[model samples]
Structures are given as C-alpha cells and as structure tokens.
Target: MAAAFDIGLIVLLVGIGAWMIVVRDVVVATIIFVVFGLLMAIAWVRLSAVDVALTEAAIGSGITGTLLLGAAARLKGADAGGTRLSFPITVVAAVLCAMISASLAAVALLLTYPAPTLAPMAMQNLDQTGLGNPVAAVLFAYRALDTLLEKVVLLLALVGVWSLAPDRAWRGVPSLDTTVPPSDILAFFAQILPPFGIVFAIYMTWTGASNPGGAFQGGTVLAVMWLLVMMAGVMRAPSISNVWLRWLLVAGPALFLIVGFTGVFIADGFLAYPPAYAKALIVAVEAALAVSIAATLGLLAAGPPERMQQK
Candidate 1:
C-alpha cells in the first residue's frame, strides 16, 4: 500500500510538471510549478529527509513560487510579441529533454544495493563538532567550505540581479504591488502572523544543532515574513542605496569569512574550529547567516528596484 501510494504521488507530480510545460497561461503554469514543489517536498518527507523537505517547501515552493507569480502578474501582456518555435525545433527540444530524463532514470535504477553512504564517517566526527545533528555537523564542520561557498554564490546571484536594473532606477526602492485592501484577509494575516513567524524562525535557527532545522530554513521563514509585511503595506521596502540594509545583507557572509580565516591562525586550517568552541562558533555563524540570508532572499525576490526614492 505504501509503495502504491508513492507511485501514485510520483505520477501526479509528473502530470503536473508536464501540464506546467504545455500550459500557455503564465499564471496557471506558475501555480502548477508551486504544486510540483509541494509534492516534491512531501516525497522528501517520506524519504525521512525532513531538513530538505522544509527547505523545499519554504524556499523552493514559497519564495520562488511567489516571486515567479509576481513576475507573471506584471508581465501579463508582455508575451504577445515573442516568436513561436517551429514544429521541427519543438520536436527536437522534446526529444533532448526525454533523452536527458531517461539517462537520469537509468542511473537511479543501476545504483548499488545497500547504498554506500558517509553516515558512519559523519557520525564519527559529529561529537567533535559538539552538534547532535549529523547533518548540521556536516554542514558546519565536515563540509564547511561547501556551505560557505553556497552562501557566496547566493550573494553573487543577488549582485547579478541588481546589475540588471536600469540606470535611472538604480539604488531605488523596489516597487511591489500592494493594491490589496487593508481589511482583506491577506492584509489581516500579514499583520497577525509575523510575530509568530519571527519566533519560529528563531527557534529553527537555535534547534538546528540538535534537530532537522537550520539556517536556510529559518532564514527562509524570516524572508517570507518580511515579504508578507511588505506585500501588506505594513512596511515599506528598503531602498537599494540604504547603507544599513546592505550591511545586514552582507553580515552573514562577512562573519563566515572572518571565522574561516581565524581558524587558519588558531586551528587546523581555514574553517576549522577548536573542538571546545565548535558549537559556539557554528551557532554564532548560523545566527548571523540567518539574518543575512533572509535579507538577501527578500531583496532577490524583490528583484531590481524599480521605483525611485521620493525626495
């Protein structure tokens, strides 16, 4: 029965994904994509990867879907002039996609039984990191560089987005559509839910060392809350030129770099921590990174600022 349910879920995901591709309406396609993300999250949960499931639901489905939906709304009539692909070209693209998917499926089916894993190795070193969660240990100690580099990549992506802004609108405030009335349920929830959201974000960041929560998930919650407030017109979006805002955005990466280099002088090498201070340093970095990640994601979703600041 469990196997049957999993199979049904996979079929639903595939059908929705195909519909998203073939649907001409942007809004409908975007909604379908969001559904796909949610279904994927459920699959992750069933696989007992709750950390990944939270991230998939929050950043993958929530933030990304909201951003794409907003863009689709703004681009309502902008697709009228695009050139259509020829039948031959369309068929070629479809064939290429099918071949790629088939290759991946083949790889999955051919994998070795008992599934080689690093769980044991990770567990062995987990105690040294003073973190109860093996996943957190890997992220903050065993593979700290990989984690730091991921955050750097996010910052670079944000820079790339900002660079695309028109010169006239550079350093301006992001313009979000806030036409929703104050008495609407959206606005009411936005107002009432943020306090609880903030508490949840903090709790996730704090419990990450011992459980299936982490900076990314916590940061995503913070970002979603901020976006909600902005959407509800409870708070104005910060200008790109705001010094404090930029500092907050970079705080995590900056602190990570500082801690990384300090390790070289005091410990084994870059990103290494003394066994005694491992958990402390990791938590400090997570806290800072959570704030930075939240700010960065919020701005990224906001896209390049479009409205000039009023004098």
Candidate 2:
C-alpha cells in the first residue's frame, strides 16, 4: 500500500507540473506550484529526510509560494504578454531541456550500486560536536563555512530586493495592499497562532541538535507568523531605515563571521568551536541566525518601500 501510494504521488506530481506549465492564469499556476512543494515535502519525509522536508515545506512552498502569489496579485493585468519565441527557437529550447533531463537520468542510472557517501565519517564525529542529529553536525561542524555563506547570501538577496525601491521611498515603509478588509477569522488566527508558532520555533531551534529541525525551518515559521500578523493589521511593518531592524538584519551573518575570525586565532580555525563549547556555540549561532532569518524573510515578503516612514 505504501509503495502504491508513493507511485500515485509521483504521478500526481507529474500531472501538476504539466498543468502548471499549460495553465495561462498566473494565480492558478502559483497555487499548483505551492501544492507541488507540499507534495515534495511529503516525498522527502518518506525518504527519511525530515530536515529537508521541513525546509522544503517552509521555504520552497510556503514562503516562496506566498512571494509568488503576492507578485501575481501585484502584477495582475500588468503583463502585456511579451512576444513569444519563434517556432525554431522554442523547439531548440525544448530540445535542450530534454537533453539535460536525459543526461541527469543517465547519470542516476549509471551510479555505483553502493553510491559513495561520507555519512559514516560524519556520524563518527557527531559526538565531538555534541549534536545528535547528523544533519546539524554536518551543517555547523563539518561544513560550517558553507552554512555561514548561505546565511550571508540570504541577507544579500534581501538587500537586492530592498534596492528596488525608488529614491523617494528608499528608506520608507513597505506598502501592503490595505484596500481589502481582513477577515475576522484571519485576525483571530493572527493573534492565537503566533504564540504557538513562537513556541514551536523555539523548540525547533533548541532541539535541532538532536532532531531534524533547524534554524532555517524555525526562522521561516517566525517569518510566516510575522507576515500573518502584518496582514491582519496586528502590527505595522518596520521601515527599511529602522536602526533596530538593520541590526537584526545583519546580526546572524555578522556574528557568524565574527566567530569565524575568532576561530582563526583560537582553535582549529575559521568557525571552529572548541571541544567543550561546540554545542553551545552552535546553538548560539542558530539562535542569532533564526532571528535574522525571520526579520530578513519578513521584510523581503513585505516588498520594497512604497511610502515615507511614520513618525
């Protein structure tokens, strides 16, 4: 039954992908895209990759889908329907895509019976880091540089988004569409859900060393909760120029960098935590990263500034 279910899911996903491509309506396509993400999350879980599943559900589907839906809403009727490529160009593009897919399939099929992996080695050193979850150990201990760079990339992406603002509204408040009145239920959920969300986020962060959850997953939850509150008019979005907000925006990556440089003078070098304090430092970094991630994602979703800041 489980095998059948997995097969069915794969079929459904393929159908959804096809529908999304053929559906001319941006809104409908975006909805399908979200469903695809959710299904992919389930797929990841079935594969025993809970950490990936959480990230996929939160970032890939939830936040990214929201961003796309908002873009669709803001761009509704703005698409003048740009010129389509010539038949030959379209054929060429399709052929190239097919060739790439075929190459990937070939590579997968030709893999060694027992594919090479570093899981055993990673697990062996997991204790040294005092992290129970191999995924967390790999991220913060095995390849800390990559993790730090990833957070920096997110901040840079947020900055790129902010740069789109006009000179007049450069440091102003992001403009959310307030013309439509929010439903009472939304406001109610905004109030109640956030407390649970906050607790869950904290749990996810704290237990990440021993479980599948981590900073990005928890941070995304906080980000989504903040957006919900803003949508319900429970709180005003912060201005781009807000001092406190700016500090939060850089706190995660900045702290990560500082730790890296400190490592240069101290232990093994560059993000190397001392044996006694490895878990403690990792937790601290995750905490700071979660805050910055939440703030950055929330502001990114709120879009570029549209009006002057309120006094």
Estimate candidate 1's alpha-carbon lDDT, on a 0 to 1 scale: 0.91
Q: How much lDDT does each candidate structure score?
A: 0.91, 0.89
Which 10-residue window of candidate 1 scores lowest in summed lDDT?
73-82
lDDT of 2: 0.89
Each prediction's total of clashing residue pairs, residues at least 3 apart in sequence or on different chains, is 0, 0
Task: Write the residue-wise lDDT of candidate 2 on 65-101 in tens digits.
Answer: 9899878887886863568889999999999999999
Summarize candidate 1's per-residue lDDT along 1-311 as a digit string, tens digits.
99998999999988988899889888888999999999999999989998899999998899899889877876886873369899999999999999999999998898899778999999988889999989888899999999999999999988998897889999898887667788888889999999999999999998999999999999999998998898787778889999999999889989999999999998999999989999999999999999999999999888888879877
List runs of model 1 lying over 4 Å from the truth. 178-185
* Cα-based lDDT at residue 80, candidate 2: 32
For candidate 2, what is the TM-score? 0.96
